[model samples]
Target: MNRKNKIPKFIFYMIALWTIFSTAHAEEIMPKAFVYTEVQNSVPFDQIPWKSRNPIISSQPGFISKTWLSGSGNNSVGGIYSFDSIENAKKYVTKFFPNAVKKQGVAHTSRIFDAVIVEKASRDIGSAHFGGKISTKPGAFVYTEIQVNLPFKNVPWQQRNPIIKKIPGLLSKTWLSGVNNTVGGFYAFDTLENAKQFAIEVFPKTAAKMNAALYTRIFDARLVEHASRGMDSPFFQ
Candidate 1:
């Protein structure tokens, strides 16, 4: 099917799966925390030690998701990867990339940080393509992408729901899961400035609290447009 047709079909499948699995009472899953190291003055796009390791690692059982390599734009050698569960994710790291444990005369380094999936939502319709008539103005709508690790297995929906409501400038929020149940969420904001400000001011405070409960790493970015074009979509409303 074409991309347009796939959207609705994908939505339907996701909803059906959600209805079936919502009641399973599974534990909250978290991804392994790891940093991909790149040399500060390395050659551009040249093959390196870990260059081919990503595909091999991502194909493993517990692998949640992996980002594609950026060729020219943002030529950083590092990217994020999520896993189904912390234990499995860590096992994979130790088994496959033992050298990552120590920088040990290596040109690059990898460090694993503690992480947790705070939320997961499915059947999300892209806000940019929702077909609803909404004004797009400066500071009209903003998208906040947050990655934080928090403990508290089976986080009380009561606690999370209230927190979502309290976030300033949150027009809407949605949770999502990708391959192997990588957990994450997205928040819509009234303005780009509002989204940026929240990430700068409120997110760190929240992360600090979350880290106290569970070791956590965070990545916060603002979406320029709301077309839902990225992999992170389909789960964020």
Candidate 2:
């Protein structure tokens, strides 16, 4: 080989080392992952033996916190959860969680979100888990997601704020956007009745206006506070 064509040994080693360091740094800063799930046509929240499973769930890889949600009307049950990383979030949703619920529910749905990216927008709406505090009074929670064509950055979070603020009994909301152009939020409300009204009668209309498919559920926040606190939920703290 011609001497002129040869690369310097030091330069080559420097580039190699930099590449390795950069990759690891990126992973370190990767955002926390969020997961939401619902089991349809299931038994009432009181009947489900979630206490037996809390210890097992806390033991999962990358698990951080979780808040159980009971459906306002359908006897459905689900949870709003957080994890240390996106990979673990998807793993639980696709593999572990599904299998765990199979005996009790044949139909279930789940979505994973990138929590860090939307932190600012979520906070704007009173996301207690992010930094705000949930109402001291008992409350219910709502989860809603819609399909969209726009990228996450392009979604108009500000424009939707006015509409959401008008919701009666609303205390706070944490916005969410995830892989495959999904938009959604976790909402806290002062009363179960108001949450049911929004989930069943209000949010669907909003989704239709956006021309996107909607997925939503209402959970009894008060019922699950203890289990959630046990899992290190930020809201409880």
Candidate 3:
């Protein structure tokens, strides 16, 4: 073929290849978001009927990216579950686990919020490290919790912000109101160990200053999946 003919064909081929490559890359790095739902109730810890329902719910169709359960160390309790898709997460709650919900008699619940898994680190070296079903990727996952008392609704946001910011491994923070008859915030950490240490050392003092109690939990990324949509993009860079 002549040079002029060949040149045009080359450009067309290049365009086609570029288009395919771009599409494939987009699919590979497609942003992933997590749905976080907190369930709280007054049911007795040992008597709760999660054994029959939780396993089935967890094994449901879609994708239960990650999940974790933490006890309140007393009667009142709460737990967080993360799902790959909002639809799947909602289905598990509204459809699959109807019986479980009724059994617990969930007093109050929060709307499903989206979270993104931004920076993942290793968990091997942390004090809170307790190996589990999840893999060990050094700092891949972190968990955090704070317990505060009620009747202090008028506290300054400025004072509360610093206290949460000081906690080690805190990736993000958000406050939930009107459940468990108390007001408190949840924090995302970089490692379980860091989260545990912070709860033991720093959280108490902060809670005292705010006139609140403190409760905390931590997990590895393999065991914990988070999706942050709308609030703040985990992939800001």
Local accuracy of candidate 3 as per-residue lDDT tens digits, 1-237 = 599999989999999999999986444333222333445644453454544545555576554333333332333333444445556656765665555556656644433433222212112121111111122233322333345434324535455566565556665544433222344444555676776676667667766876665655443432222221111222111
**Candidate 1 at 95: error in angstroms?**
3.6
Best lDDT goes to which candidate? Answer: 2
- Candidate 1 lDDT score at position 145: 25
> What's model 2's lDDT at 171?
85
lDDT of 3: 0.44
Q: What value does the lDDT take at residue 172 in candidate 3?
A: 54
lDDT of 2: 0.79
Pairs with steric clashes in candidate 1:
33-112, 33-113, 121-175, 121-176, 139-191
lDDT of 3 at 158: 50
Error of 1 at 222 (Å): 9.9
Stretches > 4 Å off in candidate 2: 1-31
Model 2 pairs whose backbones collide: 70-219, 70-220
How badly does each model clash, as a count of residue pairs?
5, 2, 19
TM-score of each: 0.37, 0.80, 0.40
Reference-based lDDT, each prediction: 0.40, 0.79, 0.44
lDDT (C-alpha) at residue 49 in model 2? 74
Q: Which stretches of candidate 3 lie over 4 Å from their true place?
A: 1-98, 101-153, 179-181, 210-212, 226-237
Which scores better on lDDT, 1 or 3? 3
Clashes of 1: 5
